[model samples]
Target: MPRHNSTEKRAARLVQEITGEPYTVCLNAVRARSLAPLAARGVPRNVLDEVEDELEDAYGLILDLPAGAAPGPVAFREPPVAGGRAVVRGEEP
Candidate 1:
């Protein structure tokens, strides 16, 4: 069991508050997004490496984001037309 420092604990808590995920999962996501910036700011390489290890350990616990949260490419499908009437899949006639 890895012991988290005060800064790490606070980071995990803040991420959980924003993302509604467990601390470990939030930590992994936050670390993944912040590693490069943190390294650029002169944070030690060894510390960053530890964070990477944590991310790898917690990878499986990360939750799937809601559909609207991370939208993928929009695919445009041809409208269905029958008997001179156009039908939209989820709209009322």
Candidate 2:
């Protein structure tokens, strides 16, 4: 029988089961490597640099709009006629 450390064997088995890939050499020898570049083309560099430039150039002002600011005159004008009768006049029920 081979003298295999139980911990090492368990670690290798776990990695294989989790990754669904068989462990070739040893448990401690396994290494985690980036698979994004292989799976998909690597992300483009300087992606945020372009956005940073635009953000630095952008500028705006914050205005303190007063409360109860009506766009036009706030008068109690009679409402227009509806259904051939003025609703404000109480002519139509």
Question: Candidates' TM-scores?
Answer: 0.31, 0.25
Please, what are the lDDT tens digits per residue for candidate 1 over residues 27-75?
Answer: 6546445544333333333434444555446542222332333322222
Off by over 4 Å in 1: 1-3, 31-93
Candidate 2 lDDT over 12-93, as tens digits, reads 4443332233354324322222222211221112211221232233311111112332222112224333323112222223
Lowest summed-lDDT stretch of 10 residues in model 2?
Answer: 36-45
TM-score, cand. 2 vs. native: 0.25
Off by over 4 Å in 2: 1-4, 25-93
The TM-score measured for candidate 1 stands at: 0.31
Per-model lDDT: 0.42, 0.29
Clashes of 1: 0
